[model samples]
Target chain A: MDSRAQVSIEVALVAGIAILVAVSLVNINFERLNLARELGEGGEAKMVATLIATSINTVHANGAGFELTLSESKLNFTELTDVDQGTGIILPIIIDNTRRKVIVGRNMSRTGHKGQWNVSVSMVPNNVVRQDPTARYPEVTIRNNGTNVIVYADSSKVRVVP
Target chain B: MSSNRAQVSIEFIILVGALLVMVIAVFPYILKTNELNKALSAARDGATFGAGIRGVGYQSGSVEAPPGRIKIKSVILERLGRCGNLECYRFRIVIMMPSYYSSNSSYVNSIRSTIRNQALRFVYYAFNGEYPASSVIYRVNTNYYSFNATTDVEYY
Candidate 1:
């Protein structure tokens, strides 16, 4: 080939390689952003779940009932009632199945996917978990459920109003 | 010939500089993504396993902050350890039995609530995506208080 033709061929190869590298870098950047958003959602969802769980736990722990006002979000509960509490007369806890719930998917409950996370929380184990937190909880307020309110969070001094 | 060599060296410098920029910009993202992915995976697993934990964490009105005072009921905080590299947090369920009202219904209820709340916090934060596992169950408590730790992690 002539010198000019050889130069043209070499330029084309270098340009082709450069284009490939640029495309790959762009793709990796996109993937990182997408993955960050996805993981953030999961983390946020789990944080909401943890917040709700703490509230319910406080209620059951105090063995009293209080109005649990949560922002609109998906909620799931498992009957933490002592299966072995033994049949005997004792102080009654007013927590129903609704209040005792430890919600997992906070977004699903509020978003279009209503009633989608109705899985029986029967899977009991001790270990780590996967969470996708994307529930927007601007505020959590406690309301009056009834008399005999034992304990309350979201407050520095949680007093029981009997 | 010298002019041509100068142009080639400039090209080489440009390539090296571009590589350095790419490394500086992209490597941190890769490392962060890896850490986040690890955190998400561990959190998910912990949440699933923690769901079955029928326990609580209890802090006396006197205690302030996490790894504070864990009132002993069925829950017990063995020890609290800080992170050497990162800030690691944990729940230590101290075995504080208010002897005056050991049998009192209201007092027992108070202790019970403390246990439940503390247990929950332990699992939740212990599995936090950040930091290493520096928290340990205190040695003072026996296996009896671990409360079927195999299935429920009853470290109260």
Candidate 2:
């Protein structure tokens, strides 16, 4: 082969290697983007779960009495109303004492896909209704697409409600 | 012939151009991996801090705010998950504490109230997201008391 042909062969080899590297990098980036999205969703799920748990705690604290009844498709809070403090400022807001279903993809839409988000929330109450124990924790289970993440939060610690 | 040599050089140039295109296409993936690693580290740190605070609250029966408060915040970028948009994650740190009205309460109700108010300030500083100035409202019955003292967060 002449010197010119040799140069052409060398260029072709270099170009091929560069293309391969570039393709690999692109794949890596796509993977990373997906991870970031999942993390964001995970964060959202945790936030929602915390909100629900704290709401329950607030109801228990302000109410004359309340009951958490779990059903097959829903979790209900019965008798969930605060008594009139007589001061008449409506000290605590009266919450709806009804069973709320834990539906995952009820209102949220998935981006770039035909499938919707798989959402589920479960509550596990620690036994501290009658007694004033230092530990009163609620276990929350949030699931998305068969992947379940469990978070245990202590209402006393977070003190999200007044 | 000199013409043949010129043709060879042109081919070499074409090859080089193709290689450059490939590199440009792949560079994003490499950068994304680095970002993903950073996000994971931050998330783990926040999770650890949250867990630690809860542990202490459980053991000691009460936790105060500001100096004694434990706050954790984590963020996730758009490059990590299957989703394509950027998303921010925030958690309200929960610690086990003695009830304010209970006997031998760790802190006075006034002091606990101050702590609760300050926790949000710390959370705002930790995460880069928008939190609504107005408190989010929820509907509950008249029987339960709203804590409203825990951490509050907003993400856009």
Candidate 3:
């Protein structure tokens, strides 16, 4: 009602509005950063998936007796909170015969929430062996066994002995 | 003196009210613009990735690339029979993206244009300097957010 009271109220309202704006701006910035991070992770995962798909398709195209070994390291799985802890333990590649696609990313099973940052690429070959990695540095062997293409991950098979 | 002071106070209140009204009017526009920008970014990245995949497939029949917000719907390759001594090939690739809220289609159109150019380049190389007859057609179905490229090669 009084002049002094009016000025004090005005100051308080202005200060409150300024604080609100500041907080809102900060929150918006944080959201933007998180979105960027997610996009980057998804892009990386897709790249890895594409690489595996290309290799498998190439081997199948070359036909039987055409074998090529692809080291897991070539995939270059980037570390993310959603993926497995480290390189040695994580099995990062899966060939889905039913879907006729290849998925590249480790599944996250922490905190009872299961999800994986992965990408799937459709392939030409339908008959392909499904093999899981057993060793740390496994090399994937893609072979077209006349009728079906075989894909298996093995560390010891890095060198073939006659 | 008291009337003058009252007049100044009333004017201040009116000014603050007008400022509030303007802020409210522009807020939604700002948010919409932000959303449009995000959509454009995603679409740009997706287009680049898809073009890379098309390039790889042309070079070695193997495709390698990342998908940001676009997904490859299907890839079809038709032999188109034979062309004299050389072989003729026709391939179609479809990429799906999310639609944007804005009506300005220029952003997406530019991306589509870039993809068409890339397809032409791939076709030129596939012809292998023989100058074989080639056609690169691009169709953008906005309703389905699908971008399709059908490339045909026929020897002259």
lDDT of 3 at B131: 17
RMSD of 3: 17.3
List model 2's recovered fraction of native interface contacts, to 2 decimals: 0.00
Mind giving the per-residue lDDT tens digits that candidate 3 earns over A30-99? 4334334434444555565677678879988998777776754564333422343332113436677776
Q: Per-residue lDDT tens digits of candidate 1, residues A1-162?
A: 344554685587679769956653452344333334433443443344455446544443444344454543432122221112211111121222432333332222111122212111211111112112223212243332333322223222121111
Candidate 3 lDDT over B31-74, as tens digits, reads 54443333233333333443443222211112223232434454
The candidate that achieves the highest TM-score relative to the unseen native structure: 3
Give me candidate 2's interface root-mean-square deviation: 16.3
> Which lDDT tens digits does candidate 1 get at residues B1-156?
767766766676687678778877997676544433333333233322222211111123432112222233222222234334332323333344335444355544444443443233233232331222232222111111111121122232
Off by more than 4 A, model 2:
A1-12, A64-112, A123-162, B1-156
Winner on TM-score between 2 and 3 is 3
Rank list by TM-score:
3, 1, 2
Please give, for residues A38-120, the per-residue lDDT of candidate 2 as tens digits: 33443444344345545444444444333332231332111211112111111121112221212122111111112222222
Compare the candidates by lDDT and give the number of the best one. Answer: 3
Error of 1 at B21 (Å): 31
The TM-score, computed over Cα atoms with residue i paired to residue i, of candidate 1 is: 0.26
Error of 1 at A138 (Å): 12
Could you tell me how far off, in angstroms, the CA of residue A33 lies in candidate 2 after the best superposition? 2.0
The global Cα lDDT (0 to 1) of model 2 is 0.33
